[model samples]
Structures are given as structure tokens and as C-alpha cells.
Target chain A: MSLCEKNIFKSIFDEWNQSIQRFIQARKIAAEDAADLTQECFVRLWKNCHKVSRDGASSYLFKLAQNISIDHFRKQQVRLKYTGQMASKSEKEDGQYLMEMQEFKERLEKAIDGMSEASRVVFVMHRMENYSYKEIANQLEIGIKAVEKRMHKALKYLSEQNILKKR
Target chain B: MSESEDILLSKWLQNKLSAEEKLMLEEQYDLESLALILERQKTLEIQTVSSDQLWDQLDSKLSHETKVDKNQSGSRRKLIWVALILLIGASLAFLLLAGSEKTIQSAKGEQVRHLMADGSIILIAPGSSITFNEKDWSNKREIQLEGQAFFDVEKGGSFVVESNQGVVKVLGTEFEIWESGKQMKVQCFEGSVSVGNLTGAEKILGVNDAIDLNNQRFSDVYNHGQLEATFKSGQMKYRAINVASLATELERFYNISVRLEKIDLNKSFTGILVLNDLEKAVEYLSKTMNWEYDLNEQNLIFSSN
Candidate 1:
């Protein structure tokens, strides 16, 4: 890549990649897979940087990352069919599994929405960017104790809501 | 789910757990299920990648692609661009059907530009929304809109944008479609677009062709379709639209409730709706329509002068 192109691409990546990762993770994609898709999203951004407008770039990156996760998730669903082939009839297990997944997702979304605004943003920063308690506190201009409290509260809320799947 | 257990789990997540503490948690949940839950927890709390490593990965991919396609990169670049978007769209559309409906909504005072996995681009205006089977997009290339949007569609298969009141079908074109409340307008800026109302009657619009629901006639809104365009400088431009129609649009644009009581229903105005300044909007509308408006806490109230 040219120096100019690299510079442009770097700035865009630096700005939106963390939020993109968070968005993917919010959809329940595994962290590693989200990272991979985040990279892919920026690579496409680099390839078509000229077409992207400054105001539109962030949303474009997010939508691209989201679409990648959806695609990746669908492929995983397809793979699961092979594993389920042996145990039960396709019709019965498929319907039940889909409903369970949907319900789980809805609950998780509700749990996040129920969190206080600061807690939710702090939680996203902690999870998406892996910020430490001190880092989140410093970034949000809050106390470290407050950060820890919010993080713990968010975790507890999700757990209590039974939003995360238990094996 | 005790406080102690929560602390331990949070510590383990922070990688502060020692060998023994890890084993203790493993013993508590058992190794397999514990591992499964921990693995799933990463989704809620993401694992961050160091920026340096991510940069290297991106650099390597860029170098590899450039080295391979240096000469014929123009056509190949186009192919990759189109393919990149198409792959994302086709896959997401698949999931939208199997998973749930995927809808794109834009809030007031914001515009979102979405590039489909196909090469088509959709520029959604504020206070507008659109829905389509994300899963069916690759195959069907159809979408439903609730506000106004300018679609720059790539030439290939027929793409369709449906709204509450009408449908727009096109083979490869650049056009703007507005569908809100009882107002629906489609303008073909480039190529040709076919529009069908709630009724089945259809009209194919060539370049510069515009058709409104209120007017059955198809006419020219722009001359020399080759001329480029830019957004309306934070002001929504309206030409000879009714007060009621203007009210609905202002409600969407400002994200504020507008009550047009005590005013002539048929009074029409042609002017600009300036964003960011309620005073300017009041000045413009009241002057143009000879109407008085009161800006309230939650709503804009209008009355006859």
C-alpha cells in the first residue's frame, strides 16, 4: 500500500475497529472470530477507501463487520447440522435449537439494555477493547471503584438473567 | 453466583488466577463445562487483540494482494470490491431469514450509507427505515423502505426497493425513492427505474424521470442527468408540498413532534427546513406560509396568522 493509503487506512482502523469487535461480540460471536472478521472488515475498507465518505465510514465498517459475523455464524450453523444428523430427526431438533438460540439472544439484549448507561459503556469498553479497570476509569473520568462496581454489576446482572448459555 | 464466586470468575477472566485457583474453579464446575462457560464468557467480554499484531496481519494481506494483481488490478480490484460486499450481503441475508428479520434504521439528524454485499449502495435519509430479508438479498435483491433513500444500484440482476405504499424495480440505475405517510416519489437520475404504487399500475422512469403519488404525470425534475449532486446543506428542500406533508417530514427530520392544529390544512409552502436552528425554521416557515408557530418543550405548534 502507498504511504498515503496506509495512513488513511490506519486512521480508519484505529477509529472503528474496537467498536466493530464489540458489535460482533454483542451478537455472540466468539472473540477470536470477531477479531478475524474485524481484520477482514478493514481490509475491505482499505481496498475501497476511495468510495467511503468520512461521515459514512464508521457505519460502513460496522455494517461490514456485522455482515461478516452473520455470514460466519450461518456457516457454523450449517456445520452443526452434520453433528446433529445422528441423534435426532432434523425437523424436531432444528426447530427447538433455533427457538432456544433466539430466546437466549433476546434475553441477553434485554439484560444489556437494562444496565445503566455508564455501566453499559464501561462494560463494552472492558470487553471490546479489554480495558483494565483503571483504564476504564481513566477513560470515562470515573473512579476505579466505580468501574469495578459497574463491571461486577453488569456481570452479575447477565448471570442472574441467565442470558449466557450454560452447558 | 455468590459475590465470592463472581469475584473469582472475574479474577479468572482477568488472568489473575493462579494454577491452584484455576483448578479449584475447574473442580467446582468440572473441567469441561467450566471451560465451555469460560469460552462463552469471552463473547460477553471480548478478548482484545494488540494493535501491533493486527497491523501486521493487515499489512501482510495488503502486500500479498498487491503483489499478485499489480497489472490487471483495475478490473481485479473492481471484482474484489464487488465480491467483498456481495459475500457479506449474501451471507447476512441468509442469516436474517434463518435467524430473524434484519432491519436498518436511521435516527433523526443522521444519514447512513450502506453498501450491500452486492455492488449497490443505499443512502438512507434521516428518520427513515428499511427492511429486507438479509438472507434473500443475494437471490432476490429486494428491500423495503419506510422513508427516503437514494439507491445507486449496480448493473446486473433486477433490484427492488419496496415501501409501505409502492415498489421500485430497476435493472441498474441511480435513483432516489421517498415513501413516507401518504407521499411517495421516485426520481430516476441515471439509467431507468420502474415504480408501482399500492395499485398494480407501473411506470418505468428513464433518466431525469420523476413521478409523485399526488401527480399521475411523469415529468423531469433534473436536466442533464450527468450532473452530480450533493446533500442539501443541513436543510431539507421542499417545493410546493402541503403543510401536512411538511409536518410529517419535519417530525421525522427534527425528531420532534409537530402539531399543525388551528391552521389551514391545504396551505402549502415551498422552502427549506433548516436543521440545528429552530428559530431559522420558524422564521422561514412562518414567513413563507403566513403562519405562526410556537416552539414548545416536546412539540412544535403551528397556527394561522
Candidate 2:
């Protein structure tokens, strides 16, 4: 690559690398896996640099990250199936309470999965990644009210699922 | 729950609630359930990784790959040079046999009018260009356009104007095509034309019909009563167009950079923009939009007042 192309690629990497990783991590991927996926995303981006315009770089990177994370998740599921390993359940003194908690967790996950992508992303960014609403608004390039609205909608939808009420 | 209460609960989850708001929320909702849900959500938090360290790893990997690519390309350089020279020689010979392609370009703040061999006319907008093979014009009426242009095609075989955003094909029509960035606007003033985007989606527009496309998707479809392009009459007119779109036109007309600061770009503007005078155009826009602007050599910044 020429110095100019290298500079462009470096700038794009610097601008989007952390955001892409955070985006993947927010989807419940481990930090290490998110980093690897982020690296792969950038590699694909660099390979296809000629095809992507500078103006569309952010959306392209995000779309690439989303696909990479989804593929990684699918492969993980396949590996788990082959290994016959289930997710470790939480251990508690009261077996009945533990069973109820596990069921509630599953329902919560289901509720989150059923949310609109926009609302889910906002919710996960705030809840899992601990991003402030203002920070999320800036990162997503949306108004603060939009971020709040999505948060409200997500929480409201989850509350409607009655996961906590079961307890 | 009420909208305001939901917003308050959301704020509480972020630990951004004031003492009074917390009291209000505790009194209204089940605080125990909220706390339980928040505690369980902690299990979903992914482990945090150092961004700088990851970037370091990525940088090393990229540089290593680059080195490999460079070494491979170095060995193939001589062959590529030879192939390029041969290709250039062949192309030169071919150009000598078949006449060279012709290109017409309009400079900043200028419009160029060209009459084709088949009695068709094209008015190229400022800072725009079109290229075609004059030798094959009769057989293939195709021109590659960049930026904006108004075309009046004579009734004949299919006339095609290709742009980066979309392709306009017409049998006999007068139409204006404005292509810049990812947005392409096609307005058919007479006859009919079919506009096909890079995605293969196509729209046939009759007289006075117009369509605006963004990223190969239809954004706006409308109709106008204008007989021809307004720019052809020494003025540009827009009806309820986005301020950002208008800024793009200004940038092309004046060959300047337009930057918006703290301005709502979605705000629409409807008026005539005089193409000949930059000062008058800015004055009119500022007065109508109630905006303050700063102009510093080739750059114009518009900010909300």
C-alpha cells in the first residue's frame, strides 16, 4: 500500500476498532473472541478497501462485524453440540431457587432476543457494556431522546415478559 | 407504566437517578424485582479487553501481512510492467484504428452546451463531465456522466447515460440527472425514461415525474410541473429539498466545501438559488433559513442561529 492508502486504513482502524469490538462484545461474546472477530473484520475491510467508499466505511465495518460475530456464534454452537457440553448452571444451596433462576435467565434471554434490533442494541450497550445513554447516542449518531426512547421501549418490553414476576 | 416512569426506570438502571427520582420510583414500582433483574444482568456483561493492546496485535498482524504481500508483488513487478507496456501499445494501436473517445466538461460556475450529430442536445452542469465515443455515436448512443447534466435525446435507438449511482435509458426524452455522493436524482421533463440503479432495480418515469435514489434505493418519488431543467435557464430551483442537498449543489456550483455545524440538516428549504452569484445565493439562504455562516476561502460553514 502507498503511504496515502496506509494512512486511510490506519485512520479507519483507529476510528472503528474499539466500537466494532464493543459492538460484538455487547452481543455476549467473550472479550477475547470479540477482539479476534474485530481483527478479522478489519482484515476483510483492508482486503476490500478498493470496493468500499470512505463515506460508507462505518456502516460497512459495523455490518462486517455483525456478520463475523454471528458466524462465530454459529460455529461455537456447532462446537458445543459436537462436544456435548452444556452451559454451566449457577450453583446455589437451594436447588429449587436455582432452577427458577435458570428458567428466568432463559426467559430474559428470549425476551432480549425478541426485541427490535435498534432497541436491543441500545439495551445491551447500556446494560452489558455499561455505556452511558449520552455516550451511546454519540456513538450511534442518534439523538439522546432516541437513545432514551429505545431504552424505555426495551425495558418496557422486557418487563412485559414477566421474567421477574415469576420469582 | 407511563412513558415518564419508564424513562425514570431506565435512568435508575443506569444509576443516574437523583435521590428524589429514586424515591419516586421506589414508591411506584417493585424495587425488589428491579434489583433482582439488575443483579442477574451482571452475568451477561462480557469481559473487557484493553483496546490499545488489541490494536497493537492487529497492527503487527497487518504489517506482517503487508510485508508478505510486498515480497510477492516485488517478484511479480517485472512481469506486470511488461504486461502493462504491451497493453498500452495495443490500446494505442486500437485507438489509432478506432477514433478516440470525446469528453466534454463544464468548469466551476459554468455550463456547457453540446449538440450531438443526431440532433440531440446536452447541457452539462457546472463541475460536471460526460464522455462518449464520437465514432460509435450512431450505433451506440451511450455516454458516461459524472455530476449533473440535462439531456435532450432525439427519437431513435435507445440513448443511455450511465452514472456512478444509476443508469438512465431513454428512447426519446428530455431529462436531468444529478448524481453526487450516494444520491442520484432523475427528473424527466418530456417523453419517458427508465432509470436503473446499480442494484438492477429500475423505475420508468413519465414526463414531469422525478425520483431520488440513495444507495440504489428509491428515497423519494414525486412530480413537477416544470417543462425543463431550471439550471438551463441560468437559475437553480428547489422545492422542499433538504438543506444538506442544497449545500451539495452549492459546493459544486462554487467549487467550495460546505460544512454544517450544530445545524439540523433535515430541515427543508424551498426557494430559488441563483447559480451565477455565490454572494447573493449565500445571502438569500441565510436570510430565509435564519442561519449564520462563516466563509473562509473555499470553505463555507453554516451554523444555526
Question: Quick one: best DockQ, which candidate?
Answer: 2
Deviation in Å, model 1, residue A53 alpha carbon: 23
Candidate 1, residue B253: Cα displacement in angstroms equals 1.0
Local error of candidate 1 at B25, Å? 85
Clashing pairs in 2: none
DockQ for all models:
0.11, 0.17
- Deviating ranges (above 4 Å) for candidate 2: A1-167, B1-99, B238-245, B255-272, B295-299
Q: Give fnat (model 2).
A: 0.29
Candidate 2: Cα lDDT at B128: 94
What pairs collide in candidate 1?
B85-B117, B86-B117, B93-B134, B93-B135, B94-B135
What TM-score fits each model? 0.45, 0.41
TM-score of chain B of each: 0.62, 0.61
- Candidate 2 lDDT, tens digit per residue, B26-100? 776676776777677666433445667877887787787778778878889787888899999988877786967
Tens-digit lDDT string for candidate 1 (A1-167)? 33226676777777777667666665445566777888888878767777887666776776676446532441110000111222235644697765654454455556665664445556666764577888666554455655665665566555555554543
- Would you list the C-alpha lDDT of every candidate in the order shown? 0.65, 0.75
**Any runs in candidate 1 off by more than 4 Å, and if so which?**
A1-167, B1-100, B215-233, B275-277, B296-298
